[model samples]
Target: MTVAEIKVIAKEMGVKTSNMKKVDLIRAIQRAEGNPICFDTHSRENCGQEICMWRRDCN
Candidate 1:
């Protein structure tokens, strides 16, 4: 998602988005949701989270 879109989600979740990069923001969001902070970690090849919402955007 775009930074703007991610910022919206972050705001709703009470995550401070200032000065945060997209990957960091996403990882923070994942942490907030009690999920793995695995975005762009080069784990996609072994990441079996097919139903994850961030799958498409993951590297």
Candidate 2:
């Protein structure tokens, strides 16, 4: 994945994207995408136009 995408995911996850390791970010994203609860709580359940699950909140 690209750095920009990682950053975006990190941001959605309420993480400091600029300071996170790529490996860690990737893992968080995978977990968020894998679970509906995390995705809904942080990523997709938002009312705003931009809704992204706390990509790290799953695992």
Candidate 3:
């Protein structure tokens, strides 16, 4: 998703988006949702979260 779209989700979740990069913001959002902070981690290649919404955007 675009940064603008991510920002909207972050705002709704009450996460501070200022000064945070896209990866960081996504990780923060994952944390807020009680999920793992593994948006673009090294383990993405073997990621087990097949149903994760952010999977498509992950590098």
Candidate 4:
């Protein structure tokens, strides 16, 4: 997803994203959703979270 879209999601989640990078914003969002802050850290491209919303971009 684009930064704008991510920012929107962050906004809805009450996260301040004005100065956050893409990765940071995504991790923050995950924390807000009570998920792990594991964005872009899939070592083998095989994440265990089957229903992860960030799967498409979390390479």
Model 4 regions more than 4 Å off? 44-46
Candidate 4 collision pairs? none
Candidate 3 ranges beyond 4 A from true positions: none
lDDT against true structure, model 2: 0.53
lDDT of 1 by residue, 2-59 (tens): 9899989999999999999999999999999999889999998888888987888999
Off by over 4 Å in 2: 13-18, 35-59
Give lDDT tens digits, candidate 4, residues 1-59: 99999999999989999789998999999999988788988642555787787887887
Model 3 Cα lDDT, one tens digit per residue, 11-42 = 99999999999999999999999998889887
Among the numbered candidates, top TM-score falls to: 1
What do the candidate models score in CA lDDT, each in turn?
0.91, 0.53, 0.91, 0.86
Clashes of each: 0, 4, 0, 0
C-alpha positional error of residue 4 in candidate 4 after TM-score superposition, expressed in Å: 0.1
Candidate 4: Cα lDDT at 26: 92
lDDT of 3 at 19: 93
TM-score rank, highest first? 1, 3, 4, 2
